[model samples]
Target: MRIDRTALTDLAQGAAFLGSGGGGDPYYSLLLGQAELARVESFELVPLDSLGDDALVVPCGWIGAPTVSVEKLPSGLEALAGLKRLERELGRPIDAVLPIEIGGGNGLAPLVSAARLGVPVVDADGMGRAFPESQMAIFNIRGLSACPSVLTAACGALTVIETDDNLTHERIARGLSVALGGIAHMVEYPLTGREAKDHAIGGSVSAAIAIGAAVRRAREGGDDPFAALYAALRDTSLYPYAGELFDGKIVDLERETQGGFSVGRVVIEGFGGSGRMELVFQNENLIARRDGDVVAMVPDLITVMDRETADSITTERLKYGQRVKIVGAAAPAMLREARALALVGPGAFGFTDAYRPIEALNGWDQG
Candidate 1:
């Protein structure tokens, strides 16, 4: 498939939703992708199954707080620099590139790199939705090595990491991001085509585009965008269930960019004396509570979006008094498995609550 300007715009919108209130905002990435579109008409998106068994596929994205990513821009050479360095280390040309996660700016990031490197992007990713740490990716959960990964900054500094521990790789990468000025681009979890097909979340790229297009078309057609978004998400195999969790105004907010992550929470009160909902985050929305009762938690996706426009409001972008709708979706089945839960469930973030499906919690299963 080819990604044209329209598709790119849809992708930006959809990726922001998939970001689950993290993965950084897609606004700048949309502009960057548009800029690239001016030079080239479209970006090539190849399916994972199309690659040869031994094809070298690299997953790439920007790392750091979404707040900083909005301010600290890339030099356009970061992805290419990282990919080239990785090629040098691997002693071969890359067959394709893919988004490390199909969420927010990270989803659009690899397009720039793929365009520059003249490689096609695989229609899949490690994380179906955004997460705070690299070790949380499905690749790591599935026992893939993240080492020999390359990190590049806008300042032309490059570092190659080689650690047996994926957690250590994330730690070193996070430190490098802060030292380099808050944000940087990374190409990690290099995969063979077979590995990508086996473990990566397939069709998420096209799914995001479809979800974005649905909302856009709904808005253009005088229909409800949020309804359209939920329908679109449910229509996709990647995100099976989705619904509005709450509709309210942000009454309070507390956010801080610390330890290479944007951590905070927002309190939202429903209209006309309705109950309140609270969301906590570490780069992405981790949990949601309604009137102090847990309604949804991590590993499931929770996103705060403009109530009227349906645009996602990331953690960094949250503001008091903003009217927003909290939306929740069931994560991909692969992420809900026992082992995967140990890596990304509510307990993984230090919550004592056991894992529960959003559908079950919200009683969506009855309908």
Candidate 2:
């Protein structure tokens, strides 16, 4: 499928929601994509099954503090440089590129690479939603190596990482991102078509676009955008369950860029003394509590969005006085499995509570 300008705009909106309050704002990537669209008519998105068995699939995106992404400007060559280097290292022409995770701005990172490299963007991603650490990616969770990966900075520096351990790869990449001024594009977990088909989150790109389009249409027709959003999510095979978690005014926030990530917590005061909700984070939102009761946690997406517009407010963009709605969606089925949860579940973030479905916890009918 060809993604034209309008679909690209829809994609940004959808991807922003998927970020779960991290992944940096898709606004910047949307601008970059629009600029790229001016030179290339449209970007091509191919389904995962379309690739040949031997096709080389590379997943790429930016990593670092979301706060820094708001301030740093890209030189527009990060993905291009990293992708070109990966092709050289592997001794073959790259067949396709996909986002390492499809959340916030990172979701669209591959489109720029696709336009520059003249390759199609695969409609799949390593992580169904954005995660703070590289090892949390489904690729790594599936026991894949993140080696021979390229980390490119906006200032003309490129480093290739080769490690047997995915955790070490994340550490090196995180350190490099901080050194390069808090953010860098990464090309990692290069996969064969078979690997991608077996492990990657399929149809996510189209899912994001569909979500954005649904919201856009609702707003245009004077319908409730949130309703449209819920319907869109339920319609997708990836995120089957969705609901509005909370609606309130942000009253207290303790956010700061720390240890190469946006680490902090936020408090949202409910209207008319309905109690308050507190959320903890490390780049992406990790957990949510309503009146001190655990309502949602990692592996389940928790996003903060503008109450009226329903546009996502990335972690760096969350402010103390904004009226916003908290949205929760179940992670893709694959991420909820036992093996996948060990890396992305609440325990992974030090929370003792076990993984629970968003629908079960919220009392929303999945029917």
Candidate 3:
């Protein structure tokens, strides 16, 4: 599928829904993507089965603290800069662009890159859900290297990791991010179209646009936007679990920006029960365990929005007295396999037992 400006707009909206509460702001990312679209004449979506096994594919993305990105705007050439450095390091022409992770911000980063560099972006990504660590991609599970990573910063800091170890590459990149002012621009994960199809979260870009459009339509039709989102993701066996809309003041929120990531939690008290609910976040909302039992966790979409406006809120922007509605959606099944479970499952994030599907947790009263 060829993506045009309209598609990109829809994609940004859908990405916001999938972001699940912590994938940074989609607004800025969309503006950047739109700027790129004006320069590039077109974009092509290459199928996974359409390329040679050894064809060179490079994934480009921005990594750093979202809180800082708001104050520190990019040079507007970061992804292009990072991709060029990687091409120089590899001594090979980049065959295509790929998104390393699926999130509101990262999800659309490559579109900007593809438009700027005059390259097509593969219709797949490394993780269906956003994760903080560099090595959390399925590429690692498939025995791929994270280096020679071509790391770039907004101010023209560039370096290459020649190490074959993903963990070592992660450590190097993390340090570089801190040194470069709490954020690093990166272009890595060089793979082929065939490998991309075999491992990536397929059709995600298309899915994003479809879901976004559905939500828009639902609102126009006087239907629930959440229900529209649920239907769009029906293929994934994921649905939104509707709970009480916490239209109360945010009593307490503790946050710390560390290691180029935002980590924290928010506590909201119900209007009547003195019933308190806590949401834990690390770049993204990982778990929304009410009182005691775990209500939702990673690999599932846990999102917060305004009770009246339905505007999505980022974890970094969450305040101490925000009336928000908590909505949970299922992630794609690609991230639900035993292998993915090991990578992003509850235990992977240090939770005790494997997480049950969100629908199961909802049981009979899924509303």
Model 1 TM-score, all chains together: 0.99
Tens-digit lDDT string for candidate 2 (1-367): 9999999999999999998988889988999899999999999999999999999999999999989988998888999999999999999999999999999899997998888999999999988899999999998889888988999999999999999999999999999999999999999999999999999999999999999999999999999999999999999999988988899999999988888999999999999989899999999998999999888888999999899999999999988899999999989999999999999999998889988888889987545
Whose TM-score is higher: candidate 1's or candidate 3's? 1
* Clashing residue pairs in candidate 2 (N, C-alpha, C atoms within 3 angstroms): none
RMSD of each: 0.7, 0.8, 2.6
For candidate 3, the 10 contiguous residues with the lowest summed lDDT are: 237-246
Model 2 scores worst on lDDT over the 10 consecutive residues at 358-367
Residue lDDT tens for model 3, 67-128: 77667777877788788888887788888887777676887878778767777777777776
- Across 1-367, the per-residue lDDT of candidate 1 in tens digits comes to 9999999999999999999998889988889899999999899998878988899999989889888987887898899999999999999999999999998889888898899999999899888999999999999999999978999999999999999999999999999999999999999999999889999999999999999999999999999999999999999998888999999999999999899989988999999979999999999999999999888998999999999999988788999999999999999999999999999999989999998999999998788
TM-score of each: 0.99, 0.99, 0.91
Whole-model Cα lDDT of every candidate shown, in order: 0.92, 0.93, 0.74
Error of 3 at 321 (Å): 2.5
Candidate 2's error at 366, in angstroms? Answer: 6.4
Model 3 lDDT, residue 139, Cα: 86
Residue 188 in candidate 3 has what lDDT? Answer: 75
In model 3, pairs of residues that clash are: 250-320, 250-321
